[model samples]
Target: MTDDSAALWVNGSVARLQGMPDDERLLDTLRWRLGLKGTKEGCRTGDCGACTVLVDGKSTLSCLTLTREVEGGSVTTIDGASDDPELKRVSAAFTAAEALQCGYCTPGFVVALAGLLKERGRSAPVEELMDGLQGNLCRCTGYAAIARAVALAREDAP
Candidate 1:
C-alpha cells in the first residue's frame, strides 16, 4: 500500500482505500466506496443521526466525520449489527418493541443505542439512554415505540 492510502476495519474486516480525497466523508466512503448502504444520509450537517456508526465502540455520525479522521479505526455499522452482541440485542429489542416505522432512522437508533449501552453499561437508566439518543430522530411512530425499545434494549443488555 502507498503511504497516501488509508485503511480501516469495517464490520470486522480490513478495508483498504486508494486515491481517496482527504475531504471524503465517512458516510460516502461506507455507502459508495465500500457498498455498506445501511448507513443513511439524513442530514449532511450531523444534526441527524441517520448516518450513525460505531467507531471503536462509540457512536459517531458518519455524515459529519471525515474518512481520513477515522483511518485505521474500527467502524461498526448496521450491517455489522448482527455480528455484535450489543448491536444484535438492541436490534432485537427494537423489533420486539415494534419501534420501526418508515425505517429510515431505525438503523441509526439501533446503532446509537448499542453504543450508549456499551459505554454506559446495561445498568444505565432509561432516561440516560433516551438522552444519549437525543440526536436520532424519526418522523413516524411518535417515538412511543422507540422509547419502549430503548427500555427493552436496556432491560436485555448483555
Candidate 2:
C-alpha cells in the first residue's frame, strides 16, 4: 500500500505528518507519532472510549478513527483540552467530586463530559447527562461521583 501524508491541527499547533498508512488509527498516530500519550488505548474497538478525543469539537473514538480521515481537521486530545477553560472547569469538578480512581479512563470521561455539556447545555436533566456519558466506561469509580462532577461543572458553566 502507498503511504500518504496529511496535515492536522493537534492540540493548538498544526502538525505535518508523513508516511501514514491508510489504516493507521488516529490513536496510534497521536500516541506514537505525535507523542500525545494521554489518550489511552483500551478495547481498540469503539466500545471502551479510552481513546476518546475531540475532532472538530465533537467527542470521537480515536482508536476507531483513521488518521487520514482527520486530515485538515482539528483534533483535541486531553492535553489540548487541559488548556480549555470549559474543560478546565470540568477537570476541577472531577477533582472536587473525586470522580476518578484508577485514572485510566479519566481522559475519555473528561472529553466525553465536555462534549456532553457542549451539546446538551449546562442545565440538562440528570437522565440526559447519564445518557450522554454512556459511551465511557470507568471500572474503578462508580458513576455517582462522575454525575456529581457534571452537576458541579453545570453550576459553574457560563
Best-fitting candidate, scored by lDDT: 1
Clashing pairs in 1: none
Kindly give the stretch of ten consecutive residues in candidate 2 with the minimal lDDT sum: 1-10
lDDT of 1 by residue, 63-148 (tens): 98989999999999999987999999999999899999899999999999999999999989899999999999897745999998
CA lDDT, every model vs. true structure = 0.91, 0.85
Which stretches in model 1 have alpha-carbon errors above 4 Å? 1-4
lDDT for 136 (candidate 2):
91
Worst 10-residue lDDT window, candidate 1: 1-10
**lDDT of model 2 at residue 43?**
95
Q: How many pairs of residues collide in model 2?
A: 0
Scored by lDDT, model 1 comes in at 0.91
